[model samples]
Target: MTVAVGLFGYAVAMAFLAPRVLPRLTRHGVHPNLGVAAWLSVMTSVLGSWGTAVLIAVADAAHTWLHADRLVLSGLHEAEVIVTGHEGLAAQLALLLVTAVPAVLAVILFGRLARSQVRMRLRAREHADALRLTGTRMHRHSYADVVLLDSAERAAYCVAGSPNVVVVTSGAVAALRRRELAAVLAHEHAHLMRRHPLLLTVTRGLAATFARVSLFPVGAREVARLLEMSADDIAVRRHGREPLLSGLLALSGVAPAGALAASGADVLARAERLVSPRTRLRRIRAALLTGIGVAVLAPLLVVGAASGLLLCLI
Candidate 1:
């Protein structure tokens, strides 16, 4: 009963409620990073609870159903159920599903994680090769390694895996003034110094493994956009707004795989704020933080309540 309830609760929330709650977080002015963290915490916690429930059910089945013909119903042993094939076929099928789904989910999660790591390494290497062949090494930025590509597509991007590489296309060099180029480089450096690549990779793993869960997909995208914004903030501090804004306008191409680029459509929304940066509203920030806290704790609440109720009924 405990296992059944936990499975039901997690599935329903992941498939339904999570999707609804995520957009609400954005509406409430939740910072993207905080929202991502909350979604990750909640999704992982629910998986944890579901895995525990499945293990308990499987162990119970192994000991009582396969090894013995009957189950002992606690200390008194007054009430009991048949544990072997004597039970109805429905009971056996339920037992099989209860034990199998969690294990399958675990396998799928690990497989996706391994695949993502492999893909990231390959992407990092490919970016390094592309830059080395088509680009020239430039004076290293204060915080990051740099390469300058001789291309006409206004692009500036950085990949921060083992072979960390930053590439700036010549188009950007020509399009952006000196200050703007410096600002763009600073933005890419911010990505490396902050280790945004690793963050995105982890979120990517979660998103791939739990694609059915809206939070995971939403969180992954939110993290990507937030990392860009966070880097923008750093660039603003380093060289003020105009340089960064100009660079952003000049270089608005898709970032290469495993790279954080200078401009994205997600950033277009931030232009107004660049002209007149306003303080984050305290109340909204607090509310968003609180929402994150609740998301982090919700899985525990669901499993705990289910456990309590099942215990009472039993």
Candidate 2:
């Protein structure tokens, strides 16, 4: 009963609120990292409910198996073993089917993650090779892993892998003022230092899982954009507003394919934010949003615990 309730509640809440509420949470102009945190929390809770269902289903199946056959406990050693109406077989088959769904989904999810990691590694290696030939080592802003590539492309991207190198194309180095370059480099390092790509990959995993069903992916997409904002905030603090804004406009969309670029596609929105940043969210707003996220997550935790109790009771 608890498992059934959890499943029902999860479905209704996601179907009704996720598409709208998640976007609102992520779209808020302040503290984008906090919004991403909320998104992870909500999605994790929903995922927990799915796991609870699987466990409870397996337990119920096992309990039914024990009760459905009287002869096993009837003290009739000579009696023929029988399952009336073949309910035992049906129960086992249902359990198998229930288990198979999550199992298959897990395989696919991890396979995708592995493939993505490999692709990123390959891209990093290619960048490393390019750096060897046409690149000159530069004074590291934050660290010595920085390199300058002799290319006209207005790009500044981070290669996050074994080497974790940050590359600045010659065009950007020539075109941007010292402070502008500082802001761009600062932004990319924020991505590297915080490992924002892994965050994005995790969000993509969740998005792929619920791609056809809910508005969760919208939240994930918003999270990606917000991550960029998070980095922008860091850059602004280090080099002020103008440099970051100007650098963004100059190096916009110059990131190579398969690279995480500082000034990627959302140039206009980022530019606008730099012009007049949103009023930093107040503690009240933060508390309120945190409460809402906790509210959404709490039900799943309660339901999971209740389902576990049901499993043990039977």
Candidate 3:
């Protein structure tokens, strides 16, 4: 009974958590990036909660198995063991206090932080309303506008709003021809259309949380890179490979901080991949296969593993 209860708890936790984590994984790869520090912290706390729940459930199962003669009150005995050990009530209460407090605090703190970021983003959108130019219908929603700024630095950035505008400096505009500019716009549009800022914001919280708990940071960073590629694909599809590639090369020279530049980092490689028909086919095939595999395997694997562990202890 204890084992059953533990397994049930595990299932509930996974049901809530996996959906949040997996989408981020596919949308972005799992890597560490500097930008998502706060989000990473929250994610780490989330992951930590997951880890704690798993551990508690396993321990509960094992304890019940070891003390099968106790009253068959479902997994209550196992839970008691987690809180008090096999000793007296005082020991159990002490254990529960020690474990439960931090776990609850971590959840509350991280959750608050995530909410704060969301609020800030919403506020940023409100601020952007004042900046909207006349005759531009782009601000109707959170769609990024691609505009020119008077700064000396040539940069491409999304101001992030209902019509989240992507801004490009005149220097960048002058450097690229019409097609290249279109490609740049397409890439930024993909970011806006996908609501990437929100996604990235969440991911950043996760990354920061993970870092605090000393878990893996690579997952969040990888997600960031993949999101960039996904946006690149959108650009390539809309504007053609040549234009996107040219835009990447041109923007690489003048990419700036705090802005999503069309080129820089892995932009060139992404452009090359876009231009290569073979690479495109392979990427499509791989993505399809991965999606199918995950769809089929996730439930079976998660359930089977959790059940098998419970049975082994029982």
lDDT (CA) for every model shown?
0.69, 0.69, 0.56
Question: Number of backbone collisions per candidate, in order?
Answer: 0, 0, 45
Error of 2 at 29 (Å): 3.0
Tens-digit lDDT track of model 3 for 1-314: 33334433544554355445544434322221222332343344344435555456545545644675552454456555544346777866665565556556656766876776776677667645644552233333236544556655555656566666676666777888999988887887787787766666665555555454322345445556666777777887888878878777777344432234466446655665566544244454454455445434444455567667756765
Q: Best lDDT goes to which candidate?
A: 1
TM-score of 1: 0.83
Q: Identify the runs in model 1 with alpha carbons over 4 angstroms from their true place.
A: 1-4, 7-11, 27-32, 66-82, 88-94, 276-280, 310-314
User: How well does each candidate superpose onto the true structure, as a TM-score?
Assistant: 0.83, 0.78, 0.63
* Residue 75 miss distance in model 1 (angstroms): 11
TM-score of 3: 0.63
Q: Which consecutive 10 residues in model 2 have the weakest lDDT in total?
A: 76-85
Alpha-carbon shift of residue 128 in model 3 (angstroms): 3.6
